[model samples]
Target: MSLENNKAFASVLTAGIILLASGFAATMLYHPQDLEENAFKIEVADSGAEVDAAAPAGPVIEPISALLASADIAAGEKGFKKCSACHSIESGGANKIGPALWGVVDRTRASVDGFSYSDVLNGMNSETWDYEALNEFLAKPKAYAPGTKMGFAGLKKVDQRADLIAYLRQQSDSPAALPE
Candidate 1:
């Protein structure tokens, strides 16, 4: 082969060798490993098949009505920062990925104007955002309403959920009275 041809072939071979070596080096430096357990776990409900009547299902969720009376609204506001990404809590706020949450406490489900709601939430025209309803929904969104478009994994802490709900109540001009 000509000197020029041999030189080009050598350069191509060297580049390929360097690329292969870098790939191996990268794998060694940053290898993936299986997690020991999931960082966050979500509960999914059973299908339409009937469950054993006597057998108690999953963990029993405690009602948060009493907790709301003393819920730390400040802490709840802090916790709700994560939700602000998709929702706007200010009065007359525009909708984003999720609907505007102004006056959401005690508001009817899927009642926000100009926001496209998921079929799951839209189907609940008769439902209201009552304290107990919010508690159960925030505890486990998917379990509360299956096929919901909401992606939140649901807060595991009852206190945190209560606090958030309390803060939400304050956002409205006329907050609904706490449950009896």
Candidate 2:
């Protein structure tokens, strides 16, 4: 090879070697440590203990009817803002990513005229959008209908779900009666 070509090749080879060495050094210095040392240790209850150690931890969910009695419509409207991206609750509102929810409270499931529904939801056509059903579905859409296309994570708070339901009920000309 010519002198000039030899010099250029050497420069490129040196640069590549430096980069490879730096990467190897970084990998060695930042190597991941064992996480077992920081792992949480769950305390198992004794055979005579009142609580069941195997039972999952979390608050017990109350019935939907109980929550609706104290639900504030105004707060629901505010919370509905999160849903506005995919749903339109106004009467005669056009469907967005989700079907229009104007009269969804008592309407048949997956009955929206032009909107496409997931196979899971369509199969549930016999069901009505009653308070209890709405409560369960709003709490976790994927859990309620495993193959549902709705990407919403669901409302975690019972009060928020009740408020949202209340606001939806108001959108209809003849709202469904609250659960007893």
Per-candidate TM-score against the hidden true structure:
0.78, 0.80
lDDT per residue as tens, model 2, 34-71: 88665777533245448777987444455678777788
Go through the candidates in order and give each one's C-alpha lDDT.
Answer: 0.90, 0.86
Mind giving the per-residue lDDT tens digits that candidate 1 earns over 1-180?
Answer: 899999999999999999999999999899799999998885556885988989886667789999999999999999999899999999899999988988998899999989888888899968899888989989988878888888898999999999999999999989989876
Q: Assess candidate 2 and give its lDDT.
A: 0.86
Whose TM-score is greatest here? 2
Steric clashes per prediction: 0, 0
* Residue 88 of model 1, lDDT score: 96
* Model 1, runs deviating above 4 Å: 17-56
Q: Could you list the CA RMSD of all candidates, in the order they appear?
A: 3.5, 6.8
